[model samples]
Target: MSVRATTVLTHVTASAPILLFIEENGACNTTYNQPPLLILERYEEEEHLNLVPLNRTKHPLCNYVLTNRWPIDQNWLYVDDEGLHTKSIDREDVSIAFMPVSQIQVELNLHCGSDLRMKRSLSTNGEQNWLGPYDYGANKWILTDSISYNARRTLVNLIVKDINDNSPIFVGLENEPIVVGYPESDIEGFVSPRFLVKVEATDADIGENAAIMYWSTDPRVVVSPNTGDVHVHNTATIEDNYRFTVNATDRRGSGNTGSIDVLVKLLSSEEIVVITVQNSFLDDEDQVLSALNAAVDYDIKMLCASVVTGNIEPTYKRQQSDDLGVSLRLFVYGIKSQEAIKVDRLTSDLSDSNIVTVNIASVLSLQDHLDKLQICPLPGRDTGLLVATIVLAGVVLIITLTVAVCFFLKRKKEHHYDQFSDRNSLASRNDSIKSSKSEILPKINLDELRKSEKKLQERLDAANGSSIAANDMLPVIIEEPSKMTDVAQTPKETLINISAPDPKAPIVIQSIDKLKDSGADSDDDDEFGEKNKVRRKSVVTFNENVEKIIHLEDGLDEESSEPDIEVYKF
Candidate 1:
């Protein structure tokens, strides 16, 4: 089933327009030479015309404009001047890509079916071909991907909607332009002409259709392009009719303009300067007065005073009065300036007009204050805090390094001590063990002890065989002191080699105690063989356990025991 369709590439001068309808079965049916319905239509695009599908019957989903309303519903989506919009929609499963209206034809894709469905056939990417031919009579259609689709096909419908819907509106206007300034009243110290009047407008359209630009037709008046802000000439006089029209135009151009008639008059222009006096301390009223006098001399337009307690930084001390014109700031700070005064000059803020700082310390007298108006002393510049901070940081660093070094040295010493102690204990234990091993042996020499015992036994035997001599016997005779006899005086001990007595021989024994008692003190002691040849002899007898004992071989009886007995030698 072939159908006839009109293309934008060429125009046919036909009496009636034709339309092609695709049926549910794979059939394309055409209706030609349709009776024309009268409708007024206009197209600014002269080169081509794009015919859309179902352009008339599609109704807006809402009663009035709901874009500006708050607390919208959740389920359904709405379309406004900003294109399609949804209140709260999930973007995870279905993603939305925004493109301009001109790119609609290029982005059009037919998925499972050529028709638009809320569920299936929503969108396909750029890789797939959008739509092609189907069978002539088949009830269902299929794609190359073997996806079965309902053959009821609807084309990609281009919505012929959201044309130029609104015009610009003007905001906040007086009956006529107010007399903002006077030409003759242009005094140097007044507050009237230092003001700004604002003129503005708004548009509710979206995108390029909503951007409103502004301009003025008159030479005396000027309008800001972006904000529609109106600025008049400062030198405007009252004789001039400041009447002019301010026009606001949307980006669509042509008939989208909104305008308002404004009549402005310049009563006069006066250069008024405001002088703000900021001071504290109730006792400094005299200083404040002196400052005010200085302002009067400089033609200060506005004078004020602000009281504060604590100190303020120099940078933030200069208040920004961009709306106010040229003014002087006299900061009568009650702080003393002996040690802390250090600044010379600071940046002046002239965002709107030039502003200068006048110090209370510099304004001692009227003449001094006058000289300072043209040449104010610069703000005090102090760097003591920064320098002190740097010094403190350096000291901390030194202390930290010293502590670290000390800790390292202490650890090293402790490690060395542990090693030394271990070595010393091991050495001492080793020496003790070695000494114990050496001492586990006999104390005496075996050979020397055996020889000493043999010598002692031999001596015992030799002393048993020896005998005493006969001369070893002593006779029992006493010598008197009166007799000068030459005899051995000391009692003598004679060692005589004597044999053992025969077992039959009797021994003669005498008590030496009786002989010692009977002293022979005879006067006739020298009468025996003359004095020099005296036969006086002290006799010693035999006894047991004595050194030598005399023995009579046969002359003496075997049982003789007497006191003061004598024995003779052979």
Candidate 2:
């Protein structure tokens, strides 16, 4: 069953507007001129305006009209300004109905006996649409609508939100410029002007932003970008200000700039000159003299003494001299030409004698001491006699020692030989004395012994049948008394051949004179006659002694028989 109910809806309108409400089917209606209690800005788009409803009562489950106007329809009118009035044409003849703003819409929709359906429809009157959510009789509704907004304001919101959220945003400042010469921040009088100068500026912004252009506030200073070379007037005075400006510009024509001030002043025109003296003892030249001209001395006389010793080569000395000469010449030239300060006197006095001794002594002390080592006198330079004397002294000492030892040994040997000779001489002399006394002594009575030996020999010969010579027997009776007395008185020693007392005595016997002249009369001697003569001498001596002994014996025998008997054993 379909029913159409008509109510004269009135609206106060200065402009077309869309309305919002619920449909009789109980779904929210976004249709134009239907269930419209809420109004919004118009939608002129070709599509139907989508309207929304606000729950005026602030209810959670339902939406109701906020106003109490009796003639309210599902979605009808709204008033922006308050003076608008509306009267509805009531159809009293039909079934008259009034809603309690909330229950009326619900009852009407429930009386329709069907679930609600919603649509977005346009009004036949051609009013512009307002976009909002519509909840005619639903339990809930979300109002949605769109109004033309500012895109710029939306972007600004996003930016503001990022800032409030502490999001990252990058920003950079322009780079500072670097200027030539003295910086403005520099202390005064620190740097002088008329010096070569340069200036530069940099910007963090890219492209042409980083380019630094230089400028000069003072015309005296020139700034060049192509070369980055700054040149100032050479004659600039101390009071002169050479200000250079450097500008850093970005592609956006934004940049920073800096400036430098350069002051020019004259240098003191006084140069300090210090002189230090050095002496080398290990060099050959003694007392090196360095001479400087009058130009180097305000008082005009400068004499320095430099000495060198030991490694003492000519070259080392020459090198030192050359250095001294150069220094002196340079000093003189500098003073005379006004290029440097002149020396009126040394600033400080120094004596290098101690230093020279210390250094050179340190080097040479390790060698043998000059006094200790025997230095050969340069040959040909010393007298030759001294050298010869020394050599001779050495030789004499050696010879003297040799002679002393030899003499000592020789004397000892001589002493030993003397002792032996003395002993031998005493022994030999004793033997000779004993031998000579024995030989010279008469061993027996020579006369008597000779006579007895001859008688014995004759008796033995006669017994043995050997003939005795008559001449030998005649010698016994006819002997000369004088000859016999001569023989008897002569003391003679007998010598036996077997037992001779003298070692030098002759063994073969003969008369002394005959033996001495034997060689001279050797031819005249007759062997038999010589033998007879020898026998006669023996026989004569033997008979004489016998006669004497017989006489004596007879006398002795007669005397012995009596008391006064005298006898001798012959």
Instruction: Please give, for residues 154-186, the per-residue lDDT of candidate 1 as tens digits.
Output: 222121123345577777443333222222334
lDDT of 1 at 327: 23
Give candidate 1 regions above 4 Å deviation. 1-162, 171-198, 206-213, 224-229, 233-235, 238-244, 251-253, 261-570
lDDT of 2 by residue, 1-570 (tens): 232333244543333344434335444332212231222222111122112332224323322112222222422223222211122312121211121111111111110112112211222122123213333333222122332222111100000000011111111112222211221223223222323533334433222433455555565556664434566545643232333343322332234443444332222212112222233321322222122221123211111213333332221122343333111111110222212232222221111222332112111110121222237444564658788888999999999999999999999998889877865688887998899998895555678877766854554444434222332221111211111113224323222122221333212121111111122333344766542111112112332233221111112223344222222223
Q: Which one is best on TM-score?
A: 1
Single out the weakest 10-residue window by summed lDDT for candidate 2.
154-163
Candidate 2 lDDT at 510 equals 16
lDDT of 1: 0.37
Off by over 4 Å in 2: 1-311, 314-421, 426-429, 432-458, 461-570
